[model samples]
Target: MPEMTRIVLAARPEGAPGPESFRIEQAPMPEPGPGMVLLRTIWLSLDPYMRGRMDAAKSYAAPVEVGATMEGGGVAEVLASQAPGFAPGDVVVGPTGWASHAVVPAEALRRIDPAAAPLSTALGVLGMPGLTAWVGLDHIAGAKAGETIVVSAATGAVGSLASQLARRRGLRVIGVAGGAEKCAYAVETLGCDACLDHRAPGGAAALSEAIGAAAPDGVDIYFENVGGRTLEAVLPRMNLHGRIALCGMIAWFSGKGAAEPMTLPAVWRMILTRRLRVQGFLVFDHFDRLPAFLAEVAPLVRSGEIVWRESVAEGLEAAPGAFLRLLDGGNFGKQLVRVGHDPAGT
Candidate 1:
């Protein structure tokens, strides 16, 4: 095995992840064990959910143990295979972590078509983020035609997809993002009816007024993200029996959920008086429906009906910066880091 440099958890941060909490170290290429595959990572994905995994507090998954690799999603080309289902050169999606390479059971990952779309999209639009918005919108929110849906982080991975999907389903769409440029992209590229800047002064009031006008009947679906002020504003505007799909919270991720938690008392009032539904979701919980989702979303990617965007960082050394950009909502769409070029890149 050759020497490979990998990022490991040096220390857990008290708030947002900092460079000191992660360190790059020399590690030996891991040989595949029985029923496992050795993978050479090509693209690493940085997502806001990673903030939860960095802490020791018990949650949906175990925290990254000290001295261990920080967990993340990545696309890898098979280097060696001890499993029958996969072959060398195959690209797959896995929890390859913030590392140059890894060894894991092939069952944990789904083999992907590098030709279907950019392999990077396997971590973005046609992948987890796509599935997230689909399941949350379709199953949880029950998004319907003619109804109005409001989404935050509207230019982001999940939010962007949710906006597009809801529109295709015939729903009127509005998006909330960090700045005027992002708002413009959401309305122009992502095909939302309107977009509001969360960074604008009196942004919350602006969002409320925008929703009030766009949804004179009241908002039918709230694609919740950026919890604090955004939620506070969206709460009172929810229509009778509207739906709330909890997505990313880039707001809380920026300050480590330390600034203030947004509790929706007004929303509860709407729930009681209007019979609204608020659901929190994780994409993994809906893995059962992924094949159906991919069936629909994959071709959209190839035909370019569903566009994908990515900010690709240079190498394994660039993971820290990618992680920072994602949490700060500095990225436009999906956040990605290239550990090295894929054979496909050539």
Candidate 2:
């Protein structure tokens, strides 16, 4: 009998998850039912939002219950289909969680053409993260040419695309990343006007000064990802009537440093005084834009006009470690876990 391997959440951590939080086990392979397809996961996307799912806290999405398979999105190869328009060997992208195989409803899966791009990219640059950067920048932030924008986590999955897109729109982009190397990549590769190392010794004050120098006219837009110190640094620098696309707050995902209260009154005052338009968004709410996003970005990706990067963990068992590394600022780009062999060779 064939077996299915999965990683489950063993425990929720108080701060910064560890390997002990996950457990790996094998079970009988799942069978597809009516309107469903049995898929072999090819690429599992590891994102900062997964950290929030591990906790039992109330949020826009429900938490992954203890002992349940850790939730995630992935690209998979269809092994068997019980639905129309899908067949064996079809590659699709959907929520596959942390498992070697899954039985997903056909409605939840979108078939992808491997000939158009790498299979793994269906989980990264061409998938949810790509859609996120597009919707956040164009729809939410309403970015304009000649505007000064600051992108936090500028070298990571979403930020990388956001930075590049901003530059293409002729915006002056100042990127905030963790290290000198990532900062350099933001400017040189992502085409940011300037990049700041948020991990630099002096904390938020130093980062704020750098942002000031980068955008002497004040920040017209802020693509917020890491929200702790980076948010603190960019708030006071925002130009009057600036826009903020509130995305992930990875810095507080593990609950670390969250006990230290931010001065809400001060932040509220800045928002009111500057007339900032801050909008918190979930990419899931904007799937209607996927076709348009693909129409614009797919060509750029194929033409090599828009580039992306990934940090992949080779197997299912490596997911827990890789996820912890991601929270610790260890991943270089979009983090993914490759659990099954790709029929379309890389």
Candidate 3:
């Protein structure tokens, strides 16, 4: 029998995940049975939500059990098919885990048109990350044109799209990121009105000053991706009846900053005084919006009007290390693992 390489959860980490927490192994090559398709993974997406899945704590989704293949989204090519409406050589995007190949039900896969955009984009924009940005900004935040919007982790996959979407809608967008280079990408490439480097020496104080300068009238919508200090800084600048789309919180996900106590009383007071509406969004629950999101965002991406970036790590063995870097703010853009060679030359 042929073999396939996979990465599995070797153990749970006490704090931030290390290379020791994951194990690389070879398994029997998966074969399609009835109503199934054999997929060869080309690109795998590493997202912040996977951090929550690594822990044993309860969440909206089940955790990846110790010794099980780590769950993930991937772009793949169908090698064989036994189901209707799907055929061999079709490229697809779905939950294929951290493996070189996958045997998934045909119903789980969504075919991607290679001519429409880059195949790797199925794991970034035009896929889950794009869907997340759109749903949060449109549905949860109810963003309006001319409103001032703040996007944290603004150079990341979700944040990049979120900030761009707001800018396209005629909103004044200010982005908060870790370093000067990312801040530049947010402003120059992603078209944010202004971007602040939160990793500077003065940290949150510097961010406050930048936000004040960028959105002098006060922020009307906040797309929150990093919760810790960034959230604290944005609260004081919020306008009356401001709306916040509380997305991923990569700051405390690894337990690195878990010891720091957040002063919630001040936050609550601001919520009361500003009459803020903060809503936490889960992309899994909003899959129904994928069609609508892709319809609107795809043309813009294809025409180069909306730009996105990706940081790719080669091979399945790099998956664990790449994911750890993603959790630590080391990734420059959307973190993707090139598990296998894409036939489309992506």
Candidate 4:
């Protein structure tokens, strides 16, 4: 009878979460019930959205109650199955939460071909973040060649792919990131026409000037991920009839900027007068587009036409600290926690 290690929400945070917010404990390994598969988590994905799940507030999803396992998606190896079409040694991807082992329904798991790509990729580029960039840019924003587009979090999981895909489509891509290194990666590697560092002095005002210089034609489309000063900077520069795909607002996820004052009338007037098309979307609402997304982007990934980066913490104990660092703009790319060994090998 092997035991499993899990990290649970110990307490909710006031602004930013810390180590005291999480608790680690051991429990009996979960057993699969009928129509379920028992799995050992391989790679655990940490995204900005998880911050919202920590607060006891109403949102698209239920908040993770204190003392419960933190919710997350991961790639895992099947250890046993009571479900059809699954068996020991099968690698799968699903919502495995913050535990070393999970007993999940077969319907909730999707088997991945280890030969196709790295198994860890199932939690990154070929997974939710990849699909998010695709749907937001292609389906939602309807990005066009010859158009000017700006992507925030430019070197992040979703934004990196969005910047690359937009560049490939011949868009004049402008990127907004935290530091000089990430900004350089966005321009040199992701093929962005320009990249702005929001952390530079003079804050949003300086960023706005940079955006104006980069997109003298005015922004044709904005792939919005961070919604604080970045949004303020981009809104005034939006071209008439410009489209905005409202993705995650990571800046406000931890309630850091929620209390800031903004003139709603001014924002409303800009939208009304400019005829700006703003659409907010959730990735979960667009699962039907996954196959199409894979069909188009998978080849680019395989051929090295599209590249990705990952910042990984070595073990489960590192998750809490890594997650805290992620909220503070410390992660370079897709942030992951490696819980169990990858049988697929590096």
The residue ranges of model 3 lying beyond 4 angstroms of the native Cα positions read none
Worst 10 residues of 4 by lDDT: 253-262
lDDT, model 4:
0.92
> Any idea what lDDT model 3 has?
0.90
TM-score, per-candidate, Cα-based: 0.95, 0.98, 0.97, 0.98
lDDT of 3 at 155: 92
Per residue, candidate 1 scores C-alpha lDDT tens digits across 143-256 of 889999999988888898999999899998988888889988988999999887766777567767776786778888999977877876677788777788887666776464
- Give lDDT tens digits, candidate 4, residues 107-170: 9999999999988888889999999999999988999999999999999999999999999999
Between candidates 1 and 3, the lDDT winner: 3
TM-score of candidate 1 to 2 decimals: 0.95
Which residue runs of candidate 1 sit more than 4 Å off their true CA positions? 254-267
User: Which residue pairs does candidate 4 place in steric collision?
Assistant: none
List the candidates ranked by lDDT, beginning with the highest.
Answer: 2, 4, 3, 1
lDDT of every model, 2 decimals: 0.84, 0.93, 0.90, 0.92
